[model samples]
Target: MATSRLGFSFLLSLFLAVACSTVARQLRFVTVIYRHGDRSPIKAYPKDPYQESDWPQGFGQLSQVGMMQHWELGQALRTRYSGFLNKSYDRQEAYIRSTDCDRTLMSAEANLAGLYPPEGSQLFNPNISWQPVPVHTVPESQDRLLKFPLLNCPRYQQLQRETRQSAEYVNKTRENANFMAMVANETGIQNISLESVWSVYDTLFCEQSHNLTLPPWVSPNVLQRLKDLKDFSFRFLFGIHRQVEKGRLQGGVLLGQILKNISEAANTSRPQRLKLITYSAHDTTVVALQMALNVYNGKQTPYASCHMFELYEEDSGNFSVEMYFRNESGKEPFPVALPDCPQRCPLQDFLLKTQSVISQEWDHDCQVPSTSQDTEVIIALAVCGSILFLLVILLLTVLFRLQAQPTGYRHVSDEGEDQP
Candidate 1:
């Protein structure tokens, strides 16, 4: 009886030890890339919500509500990673970044409010809102100047064009054509292009949210249709078309940057367990990065949706990366699982899994331009296009006025009008 009891106790201790070790194994390193929370409109369309004058926070600015959303996210993250990073603030073990947009920069700050608070040696003031943490970023236009995603390779542009002409794109064009025809018939508006539809949605969504008055024609049904258009436009930017090349443009390059940071951190023996990189940008920015990594479906995810990727190194020197998505109203983050990966994932597996991308039309050797050069191009194009567009609009307005003149002024041919 004594021998049996000893054996059972030994077995129980062994089980507990294994369990503890496994738990510790998971609490090693973590990396997260998330989208910023809700914000004011980036720009106004012909019929969009609260204009620059109407928005208290101004265009593309994060509001108080946005702050709350990020704060909640920070709280959730704090709980989830409390075991891995720390229960409280640890400056030596964490970093944060934003995408250099007003909303994103503010979002990072708000998130940090929940991420780090007074604890041990990390607290600076007792009654402060929170300790200050660095949320690094460059000029918004110069974000691409940092290197990885900033290649100016001609081959990449070629691949982008190829993707644009692919079977998927052709199908999308067909779908758009049908949808446009239907909409034109319904609204009695001819030539309803993507731009027109997108403008309609942006105006409605922004206006309605900020309590700005909608246009006379902006009914519920029309508003819904406009939203659908926006989703389709996002898919065009992300899933159906530009994902692989975009991944090559952004995440593929950023992945390299992240690896470099990790390698340096490991070599230097730094304890930055929470590499809390932040990106401050628009919805398209989120879509571009997500789709390139083959993650987003060809649909709109939502406002303030977040994507998190966690890296773990096992006791045996094996590395793993787990992915999770937190939309606004979820009880728990959804696992972004793959066929080969379960909940607790591997990094190398992620690289390998996303390697194929979605389509077969991507070029591996595209070079992204420096951020300055790209920004310069955008500025030049915008200036020239603005001038041209104004001229076109003015000319069209005049032409329309002329055509709309009374028919009585136009000479009527009185050939055989028998006054029926």
Candidate 2:
């Protein structure tokens, strides 16, 4: 009996040690990219009863529901990373960046309000529960990091043109031609294509969400069909054809920055002070990142959706990356695995798999080889070279004529003068 008890104690100690070691895999860093909360429609359809003035804060501004959505998201973040983050707001520990838009900027502020509510000595105002947390942004025109589907990319534009002509796109267009025409006629839109359909759907969806009475024509079935098209449009924009190259031109830019942050955090040589980096942006931003990662589900990313990256240092000192997506307010974020890699993807493997999508030279890659420009340059050079060749030939002919013709005492001049 004494021996058996001793053996049991030994086994218990071994099990506890193994469990502790497993639990010691510390999270080194975290990065979150989230869509801004709900907002008023960016624009209303011409035939729609609701106009810009109908919304309390005007067009594209955050609604009260939006503020609450972000606040709840912030609270979720606080709960998810309670132990990892400091109890009080620490400027050194966290950074938040938002696009230079009214909705996105406000969403960031609201999210921060929830994530770091003023506590103890940190409370500045007794009357208000909220404290100011700095949210950074740049001019919309200048911001390439957060603002996605960079329309300025010539190659990306070319890709869009190509996508339109693709069999899948053509088939969809052909199948939905009557539907699109009807929508265009109903909305008073002059021409409706896959790209423009989203706006109409967005207007209706926003109105529906806000309890506004949608037009009689906008039936439940119509709304559902519009949603399907909207999702397809997102896929078409990001991944219908030549997805890898598209990603390089569009989403890869953001992915490169994310990978860089992860790398910096993983470096054990440096003092790892920063814990969390949050990007408060739009649906397109979330989609862009997921598309780059090749993990995008073909669905419209809802408002206040979050995509998280957590870098962990394992017991063996190897770093791994894990991704989670939280689209719903009530449910936990589900794990998203890197393609051909485990959920806890090794740092090196994650980098290797994602390297193709990461643009080495975005500007160079975005440059579509302009055949017209090249042809013009070649033609100009040819014209100049031909003119120079003709000039040389004319000069040589003139010199030959002077030498061969009876050039007024040209050859015999010196001898004739001496003889004379």
TM-scores of the candidates in the order shown: 0.70, 0.90
Per-residue error (Å), model 1, residue 154: 4.6
Clashes of 2: 0
Query: What local lDDT does model 2 show for residue 382?
Result: 97
Give one digit per residue, the lDDT tens place, for model 1 in 19-107: 98787564455556666776677676533334588778677777787788888878888888765666776666777766766777788
Best-fitting candidate, measured by lDDT? Answer: 2
Q: Tell me, what's the RMSD of every candidate?
A: 18.2, 4.3
lDDT of 2 by residue, 51-114 (tens): 8889899999999999999999999999999999997899999999999999999999999999
Candidate 1 deviant stretches above 4 angstroms: 1-14, 47-50, 119-127, 145-192, 219-221, 239-243, 259-275, 355-364, 367-420
Ten contiguous residues with the weakest lDDT in model 2: 411-420
Which lDDT values do the candidates have, in the order given?
Answer: 0.65, 0.93
- Evaluated against the true structure, the overall lDDT of model 1 is 0.65
